[model samples]
Target: MSEADYSRVSPFWQIEFFYCNSYLQSHSLYAKISASESPMSEMVEVVIDSIRVHLMAPQRVVVLKQSSTERYLTIWVGPYEAEAITVALQEVEMIRPLTHDLIKNIFNSFGARITRVEIVKLQDDIFYGNIVADAGGREIHIDSRPSDAIAIAVRAHVPIMVHRSVMDAAGMEPDREVPETNAPLARQEPPPPPSSDDANRLSVFKDFLDKLDIDSPDKDKPDSP
Candidate 1:
């Protein structure tokens, strides 16, 4: 779609579409969002960076990057939940259903579907999440840990959101190098890692624009020649 066409969509959906393409890479999520009334909750959309298993400690971390923002949130999770998120992100299917997969199946059989997951709070370094679903003609919100909530959200192809207050307080710009973990993010997926061609092309194009004498958005005057 053209930029002009995309601009016509509501900002919520603009982010939703971006999330679909960037993270899920599936149209199912887009379809689900479009079918529901826009949610009234004020939340910031975020995408999972990857599941990081701490090599130095017996713990796991799930990193989340706020959509269209520089802020990142890191939550410590258990190994089981870390594996669940890994399998969902990598699209790994087991011969027998894992616990998370079973939960999803139970919801499906009940005609309930997860609409979104929200990281609603952070206190004493612990983050909490809520799973929003529709079942029996009413909305249902279940309290959860950020890890388990994220795992189910990815499996359901639903949007994950973080409350603005929580993000503002706890989010940080990630370091130049992400820490090495027992679970390597790159190896989770089967496809060859993304080539740097697109990044290089975009970098070159940005440099070209930088060379032009363009005025800032706040400044109407042209640059001094």
Candidate 2:
């Protein structure tokens, strides 16, 4: 097909799927591609590897990503969503049930189950996700954050997927090295504590040493003898 004719057919077809800076950035690109193309293909698949909390906005939301890549899909979430996803990712202990935990509990209590999370659409720079659930003998769809949807998907043991068009636009090649933002925030251990016995011994040693100081002349030899 002629280049001009191909452009008229589909703009995405005209452009090659080159490398994306990051997966999230790639995803944003994919959304644009899908929008330009009428029907999206379902060939693309993505895995949710983990979630990260950015230091810049600890109070806001967290970022999500696939374990295999340095690129991340960021989501603006509430405090509760952040806490829930954090606990779930770290497997940390919480005295009280977190919001995500409660959601899972409610789902179980009502005989509803999350089947999978599908990143369905992207529009106006925003990515949208759908939670496929089986409840009351019927499947239902609910809107969710890509971060929260991913966190819950991990707990529910459901597959996480992305559209191929989105992948083509937003998918990035995975980097083996750790990302700068994902580095450890603080040292793992604190300095060892000083012992009281060692302090007392040092104090006594100082006192005895002070008595034999060469800086001072002997009192007995001071007089003109």
Candidate 3:
């Protein structure tokens, strides 16, 4: 489909909108949205539904719920990282600037604005991310840890996205059958679950999900804009 076609029927609510510069072509990127239309991209927009921790070791998990569905993508992160994301999510005023706070201030100091943050890839159990920033007129993609990217995103109120392939691999829905919506008129291959290896590898993330501290994203989140 062409850009005009995508403009007519995108399902996203509030997603990333990137402007093209010389660096954009090198990256082969598409605009995730516009004031007028939601543009399609390889990534799916998600929200930081909640930060959860369990009694188990390495317990901190950051949950990303697909914007329009119950499907979730969870990433286990370090303690400091979890706290940074939590502080940002809760809009807490810290006594002193934390590391992420410093990063945000630096962005302001340098005149670079964060356009979006993405959990770009998942490989062997490690998740990779990018913080996309607009440096003057050029778009810069910075390599970042997923936790750091999310921490920064929440601070900037930027869209956090996961690649479709990563979602297919790690995303889980509460129910087995999803009543599909926003379907294209033509037939297409359904996305497959990423080799069951991920289920085994990332299974720790699902344990606290059913526990009391963790709440369903549907209830916690407001209706998307």
Q: Model 3, which residues run further than 4 Å from truth?
A: 1-40, 176-225
Clashes of each: 0, 6, 0
Please provide, for model 3 over 1-225, each residue's C-alpha lDDT reduced to its tens digit, 9 standing for 90 to 100.
468865775455213333334457556443332121112378899998776665445557788899988889988889888878877776778889889989988988989899988777778779988888788897767778889989999898899988888898788787578577787847768678767766676575465556524345444422221
Write down the TM-score of every candidate: 0.59, 0.48, 0.65
Best by TM-score: 3
Given candidate 3, what's the lDDT at residue 82? 84
How does candidate 3 fare on TM-score? Answer: 0.65
23 Cα displacement, candidate 1 (Å): 41
What are the lDDT figures for the candidates, one per model?
Answer: 0.71, 0.55, 0.74
Summarize candidate 1's per-residue lDDT along 1-225 as a digit string, tens digits: 898999899989988898878876654432233232324465889998755544346666677889987777767778778778877777866889888888789889989888988888766657767878898777777777778889899899999998887777667654367576799777776757546864543353244333432344322221221
Model 1 RMSD in Å is 23.1
Which candidate comes out best when scored by lDDT?
3
Candidate 1 lDDT (Cα, 0 to 1): 0.71
What's the distance in Å from true for residue 56, model 1?
2.6
For model 1 the local lDDT of residue 7 reads: 82
| Per-residue lDDT of model 2, residues 95-185, tens digit only | 8876667777888888988877777665554667766678777766677766677778767778776665554444444347845675466
